[model samples]
Target: MATADGEAPRPEERQIEPLHLPTPEEIRGQDIWNNCAVRSVASGVMGGGLGFFMGMFLGALDNPIMQEEMTTKQQLIFQAKQMGRRSISSAKAFGIMGLIFSAAECVVEKTRAKHDTTNTVVAGCVTGGAISAKGGPKAACVGCAGFAAFSVAIEKFLDRHS
Candidate 1:
């Protein structure tokens, strides 16, 4: 059908934005970041950094055990060492915790096919149980229950705030 002097379809005549093709580099970058392993690792690293800072702050607040006997320089050195040790130890724990929680959440989300609090609770249980398994079955059960509860509370708080 022809319009008043129109040979083209109205859809075609309407303005259309030009398609933007992502470059090969952009495609590869997206693929790399979208990978599950990369995402877990990134989360672990970020968690570790947060834990490190927290540990440092807490360690700095600690009073030297022998402050009365130690010279000023000795006290400084002792505090520095304490901070470093605390930071590294907490960082390791936080990194593992983050990685496990992230991976578990991803798997739970994928398996359940939903994005909701149940996934968070399951992931928290898995992570906590796995982390505490070394303490024995009872500890693992306790950890799972406690973490699941904590996860639920956090989920509710976030949902309410959001």
Candidate 2:
């Protein structure tokens, strides 16, 4: 159809569908912080459990030697246990850092999934690398990486869907 001035009619006149983009009012109404916190905590629990299992496995490797030596062997076993505890502690640190980053991002973005995903993953990697350098690289790499990934994944999944 043509207008009275002979120009083609505007397309908007023929359209009635509403766009779905939320306005500032809607954005402000969403509670992103609470959701992220919940997600972060859930992930932390899972990560912590996995870390505990891994620590147990590492400690188990010293079992035969530990039982065989009642004197020097016992000391070695004690040292091994101490090392395992340290590794678990590092994993816990990484997990906590991931949770903090995810929660803060959620509070800032209010359901913006991308922000939290990026922050958590990057933070995890950095924490893992740092722990590796400080402790044995292999132990830190496995524990920190595993825990960080698990917790971050939890945070990302929940934030994206919710």
Candidate 3:
């Protein structure tokens, strides 16, 4: 910028940035969330919160099995119960999923010692297989492939956008 002297300020005379002191919360956040377990738990909680909302929305749109035979009050009660049940179920599922996925990814990244799509895919496969293990071997394999592909696509999309 030009001064009254019609000249730019010299580098030596330029203003320096002021020092910043982090707040307690900021310092605590970094300190407490510096581990894999903490990150996984946080992810689980966030996923559970999102799932709860999604379940509520879906439950609101769902028609009760015997809505035609119920009074207005009864139907409302039924819907409320359904919404609550759905939300709880979804929250649990999502929380477990998030915990599993985040832990797997963290472990995989640490072991591989690399930050790349390969780690994402491996972690995704592990998560998918674990989630689908109850369905049998065939189902697990399918889930592994599907989730790995999904992870790769997501990673690629974020990479391109960022």
TM-score of each: 0.78, 0.38, 0.80
**Least well predicted 10-residue stretch by lDDT in candidate 3:** 153-162
User: Candidate 3's error at 122, in angstroms?
Assistant: 1.1
TM-score leaderboard ranking: 3, 1, 2
Off by over 4 Å in 3: 1-31, 160-162
Clashes of each: 0, 0, 0
RMSD of 1: 7.2
Against the true structure, candidate 3 reaches a TM-score of 0.80
Tell me which residue pairs clash in candidate 1: none
Residue by residue across 7-60, what tens digits does model 1's lDDT show? 765876666779999999999999988676888899899989988998898888
Write down the RMSD of candidate 2 (Cα, Å): 12.6
Badly placed stretches (over 4 Å) of model 1 are 1-33, 160-162
lDDT of 2 at 48: 70
